[model samples]
Target: MTTKVRETQICLVVFIGLPGSGKTTLCRLLLEFLRTSCKSLSDILHHTISICYDELIPADKFRYQDESSQWKQARRGIVNYVKSLVFTLKDIEVLNMVNSLEVAVREELLKVVQNEKKTRVYIIVDDNMYYRSMRYEYYQLAKLYSFSFCQIFVQCSVSDALNRNSSREQSTAVPEEIITRMAERLEPPDRQNNPWEIFSLTVPSEKWTVAEIKKISLFLNNAAEHPVVMPERNNEMCQESRRICSTNVIHRVDIMLRKLVGDRMRERSQTSVQRDDLQELSKAFTDLRHHILEGIRTGTIIIPEDTYEAINLDQSNCGHRLQDFLNGLLTIS
Candidate 1:
């Protein structure tokens, strides 16, 4: 009897930080550390590629809302290029797809692909992924491909980042304002909140030590060994879950509105309000509640489902809106 061996899986390491946070430098040090220090990892690792957004996106396209679509396309293209490289281990098709990339980037990619053997690979994506949504995109990609995903948050203060930016080459350096803005918006991995980001590490850019490198290598090794398992998809179950959630939200809102309407009716009754007017007010309130509930069910009204606090805040706002409607009805009566 022959023993069957499991093949090594690909790992995608996403770097999240602000500009001048030393993500690119860290990438270099990590690759070198893995290649030299971790002999076991180096043996199975066919190639380690670093994909820097600075090389892929133009300077003018940075930190601008207007260029978001372009940024998205570029990021998607990079992922596609990586997928092509992994599946085909060839750069010809990848190059044709990303011909807009810098010639130097193209050459480097070609060089790496040419040297790659049939073995496991690690891809480090270097970017100032300041938003959780930005990192989630890569996470989704990893989940789709059943690949191991990990995030490295390069921690650096705004002042330190700005200082580092000042010392860089004029052409390569980012503006101080962009770095500051990105730092303000940076959402570091919260493993507790996001289960997908459980395999995450945070490293101080100013304190790079052998111990830190070892820790990073260990983290990567663990992540690579345990690739993300794709969840079983059940459309019927998903639809049922959504229906139940929607029903619950509508029920809560209806109860709140009924209480508000009852209170308003009692207040009007104490003031000798007309019976017809009271009935009309009740009907109006019922209609408005129905409209609001419908909007929630259809997602026409935005409700934050991620946290109870957000839902409470939204409910408070809804209560205020309903109160205003009651006030308007009273004035009309």
Candidate 2:
């Protein structure tokens, strides 16, 4: 006799671990299982949107040296921006799923609902979610969307991860130094801090047997039993998180702008400066400040006009470039 597992309704499964910890492998395995074992067509498709951070990196970035502070800042900022965007996209994707499901149910064409039960939306966000703040971002999104969120921590010893990295192809293998640093910094998920972690899975260092993988597949299929409690739309914590992110981004930009002005002043031979340059700089800063405030209010990020041109004027400028940065951050490339 075969046992049937209840399906999830609007769920997100995030893979968190250091690079080379088999996160991608685990994600692929689970994805295949979900697609094959689905009870219906809608369940098979599941409105699944798989987002992997590694694939989002632009080809030009591969040539960038990691030694510069400006580069490092840009990299981190871009990562944070992408993280925020992922959360935003999740809301949109869920809404789309709802619309699609509604149409499917109305048309009465497919038995997406077997035995009068509906299929669910599923998302897989694959990345090295190393920090608690990263997980918290998703937690907030899950609460807002009324989706069951699960964190799958693909755990492996530092040595095992390093060994795996070493064996990977040149195009895919992560740098050993980066792997070591991330291993040192990873924050494993805990159920104590957030109830969402209750549905979390921890894959061990050893390879998962087929039976074990099947068990995981069943576990996820039956996740609807652990329904998530959606928080109020005007939750104070969400507002606070938005405030903090906006403030940090504003502060960083302000510091860089100030340094740019200082560098220009030092380059001037005479005591008097070009009023035009000063006015342009001032206008740029003001526009950036206003746009940032707006972005915070609207839950998006912005790049002030000509900000990139100004930064690029000084070949050695330490200021973060805005155009390519924004494109990369928003995954326009």
Candidate 3:
């Protein structure tokens, strides 16, 4: 009698946690475990690929390394807008990059599965899946490919995360304040409410081992037998997601705007601008403060739609105003 081989298909495992929460550490350990465990599984030969969210960020004019110049130049204004709002815009860019990479990675994994015919292909996504929308993106991908998707949330206290961050090299360690805010805002996976949360594991205090890896492998093998049904987004959830996105965007814009104002104020102080003129500029900012606050509360950044031309025009006007103010103060010098 001949024995038939059981095969595991393409699957995704996403890590969710704050920076310095040991997410990357857990991923490295899990990958090592999976590679070693595959040796014992008689018919299972697993090929795994790891993708990091930080590596997806673009470095060139397109803000992404893999983009075409023509397409990038055409959408340069959008790129500038994204760059200007450095905080929340990174999240948006990373999400879109992840979505695009998922398709390509899935195709490659499927090809391997097709060729091997009896082997498992796993894609490990290492990132801070801090929001539900981020996790939902991967969940949708799983349903589209009919592949098992799992999440591992690395849980650590804020103090522990801070201490871990401090011990890291300067280049890798993010600011302590950013980590603190991320811990406060992190939205953990809820398996009961969302089907994409299959094989969810919470590694508390960063304790993980080969046993956890085997458990996840077993979970995915079991999950393959059952089809995933994504839950509908209720009105409440929709509202909450929107609220979170809007709040983050507004906060980032506010930070950028305040920094711009501070820079201009320092420039004015260094110039020969008179006290009266400085007071007038300060009053203008005071007036604009109300408008800025109003815009934030209304969940929008109001800018003229003339694209790059508008940006240049605004800069020219500001430069002219500052020059005139300084020239008017030349008598005092």
Model 1, stretches more than 4 Å misplaced? Answer: 1-8, 61-68, 86-118, 233-333
Tens-place lDDT digits, model 3, residues 174-238: 77877877777687876653434646877785566667767766765565445454445479976
The RMSD (Cα, Å) of candidate 2 is 12.6
How many pairs in model 1 have backbone atoms within 3 A of each other, for residues 3 or more apart or on separate chains, i.e. clashes? 0
Model 1, span 1-333: residue lDDT tens? 212222535788899887777888888899888766654444564446677777776766433331244656666667676666545332234444435444544554454445433345677888887767667667666776787889999998898888888999998888777777777777788777556788999988875787888888888888887777765537987645444445545665567667766776676677666889778877876777677667657655433333222244464444433333222222221
By lDDT, the better pick of 1 and 3 is: 1
Highest TM-score: which candidate? 1
lDDT of model 3, residue 61: 36
Comparing candidate 1 with candidate 2, which one achieves the higher lDDT?
A: 1
Q: Candidate 3: where are CA atoms >4 Å away? A: 1-8, 39-42, 58-116, 224-333
Best by lDDT: 1
* Backbone-clash count (model 3): 2
* Ranking of predictions according to TM-score: 1, 2, 3
TM-scores vs. true structure, each candidate: 0.63, 0.54, 0.50
Off by over 4 Å in 2: 1-8, 40-47, 59-117, 232-333
